[model samples]
Target: MANIKLTVEEMKYMALLQDLTGAVARDCIIDNENNRIIFIVRPGDAGKAIGRRGANINKLRRLLGKEIEVIEHADDLEAMVKNIFAPARVLGIRLAQRNGRKILYVTVDPNDKGRAIGKGGRKVNIARLVLKRYFDIDDIKIR
Candidate 1:
């Protein structure tokens, strides 16, 4: 795993998230360009992080003035990808090496292609960022 260094602001956000949701945050990614915050919580704590009717996340969004996304961490790359793209239903994940660079091939249900890609490809970009950060994946292809 690569060493991930957090800014003091991110650390403070993590502390706030933990206090608000009681979920241990594994990682936090702030996408300033997209005006969003992605939080990877310990497995089995997604519900807690989200809170009932998304109250916790909504509160964080209001407080931080950015959109919030909470994803549960997984030990396996495939499981992690699936968790990141939850509700979209990943049909499969295969790793491939091209030009000596590793890439992730993610197959999603035909009906969920749009959701997997998300508005302006934000979700796929998030997936790519997290995958590269944790697994060193060079790229991700959604099919």
Candidate 2:
């Protein structure tokens, strides 16, 4: 098994998430290089954990001083990728081998492409961060 690890910032953000949602956080991964955080919550609890209108997440973001991304605990890795791209409608997502490492390629509706890749490519950056930390992928490209 690949031994997953959390940085000190990730642990701190985990505590913040718990305090915000009163929900148990299964795993926390902080990507300092990308400046984001990803965490897992119980099944069927993604909305509650996010709170009404994302108030919970907003509060945590303010407290932790980092961008926060949340996903429901999922067993299937592809589903997890889909979850991250929710609201944007990813037409297809593929995992391919590149130089002996995994790379994620995400396809979104042509019209919604800009949304998937936000201003300064922030959204795509977040997706790449989560993909690397949670899926153990090394690279990501949205095409």
Candidate 3:
């Protein structure tokens, strides 16, 4: 696992989230440009993080005034990537070593390519960040 440092704002949000959902947040990403907050919860805690019928997430959205996305963390790299891109199915994931660097190639359903990339490539950027932090991936290629 990578050592992720949280900003003051992110730490505040994480504290609020833990108090509200009673779930441990493994990672938190504040995507201010997209008006969204992504939280990666501990394994088997996704449903708890979101609450019943997404009530917890909705409450967080209303309180924080930002969209809330909850993802479950996985031990495996491929599984974790798939979880991060939920609703937009990933066809496959390939890892390659080149020039002493590790690169991750993700294949998404052609129909959902746009969504996988998100507006202005935000989702893919997030993917790259998360992969780099946790898996030591140097880059990501979404296909």
Candidate 4:
């Protein structure tokens, strides 16, 4: 695990999320470009964060005026990557170190490649950002 830092604003968001969803968040990523907020909650708390029928997420979306995404945190890098790319079935995850940089190669179901990549590769970019922050991974290559 890498040393994680949360901005004051991020900490506020995390606090709000926990208050609203009853799930303590490990980290919060505010994607201003995407108009989205992503939260990584502690293990065994994803269900609580999402709530029944996604009521919690919907409420947060309305309150924050942006898309809200909740991901469960995992100690394992592979599991973390998989959680980040949920709804897009991942076939494999390979971590490679070259020189002084580390790269993650993720293989998703061929049919779900575009979904995993998201519009304009936004999903991959967010995944890469999260990986870099949480695991100190340098890059992510979606295959």
Candidate 5:
């Protein structure tokens, strides 16, 4: 696990999430530029974090006035990357070193590339941020 530091607002949001859904949050990323907050909940808690009919997440979105995306935490980097692109079928990942930095080349289902990249590349940016923080990955390239 990485050494995660939470800001006051993040801690507050996490507390609110737990209170609302009874789910344990492993990490929280505040994407102000995108007007959203991403929460990585404990393994096996994704469904709880989302709640029945997505009621919990919907409530949080309304309460925070920001979009809420909850992802399940994974024990390994490969799984974490996969989780980051959930709903988009990832075929594989190739790890390579360059300039003494680690980079990831991800191959996903051709048809879902746009979805994986997301609107205005928001999803890819978030994936880069999360992977850089947690795994020291320098960058990612989608194939």
Candidate 6:
């Protein structure tokens, strides 16, 4: 079996997420280079983790004193795509631009692709919005 190691911020994020949502979060990561954090949990748990309109998340941002990003997992294709582009969840992200258009491409665990895209592409849309705003990307594509 392969072992996965987590950084200090990832550990802290797990602690904070559990404290807020009482859910078991996995695959927590902190992108020191980008100054962001990411984790995985069921979509149903997202509301609790984020709080009412993101109140808990706001608190985490203040406490961490750095930018924070969350990726809610679902067990579907579109949801997985959304998860992949979630700045924090993306293990390796590459940006490509053409004709004044920007495209954000991301790679995620094969098993997680479905959950990232979500049902009927709802999650994908939301993730696209997030990527557009934060990364200024015109489009998000996952593999």
- What's the TM-score of each model vs. the native? 0.95, 0.80, 0.79, 0.88, 0.92, 0.52
lDDT of 2 by residue, 1-143 (tens): 13577678667767777777887787786767766777777777788778999999888888778777777766676677667766777888888997899988888899888877877987777666666666678877888
Candidates sorted on TM-score, descending: 1, 5, 4, 2, 3, 6
Model 3 CA deviation exceeding 4 Å by range: 32-35, 98-101
Off by over 4 Å in 4: none
The sequence of per-residue lDDT tens digits that candidate 4 reaches over residues 39-127 is 99999899999999999999999998999888889999889988889889999999999999999999999999999998888788889
Q: Residue 4, candidate 4: how far off, in angstroms?
A: 1.1
Least accurate 10 contiguous residues by lDDT in model 3: 122-131
RMSD of each: 1.1, 2.4, 2.5, 1.7, 1.4, 10.6
Model 6, position 31, has a per-residue lDDT of 53
Q: What is the per-residue lDDT of model 5 for residues 10-91, given as tens digits with 9 covering 90 to 100?
A: 8988899999999999789998988989998998899999989999999999989998888888889889988989889999
Counting clashing residue pairs in each candidate, in order, gives: 0, 0, 0, 0, 0, 16
Residue lDDT tens for model 6, 11-116: 8779877987676676575556556666666666666777888788888888887665566766544455445454335455677898999887777667767655
Identify the leading candidate in terms of TM-score.
Answer: 1
Give the poorly placed runs of model 5, Cα more than 4 Å off: none
Model 6 weakest lDDT span, ten residues long: 81-90
In the range 24-133, model 3's lDDT, one tens digit per residue, is 98888887777888888898888898999999999999999998888889989989999878778999999999999998899999998988888888778778767787
TM-score attained by model 6: 0.52
What is the C-alpha local distance difference test score of candidate 1? 0.92
Off by over 4 Å in 6: 1-3, 74-78, 83-143
Q: Between candidates 1 and 3, name the one with more favorable lDDT.
A: 1
lDDT of each: 0.92, 0.76, 0.87, 0.90, 0.90, 0.64
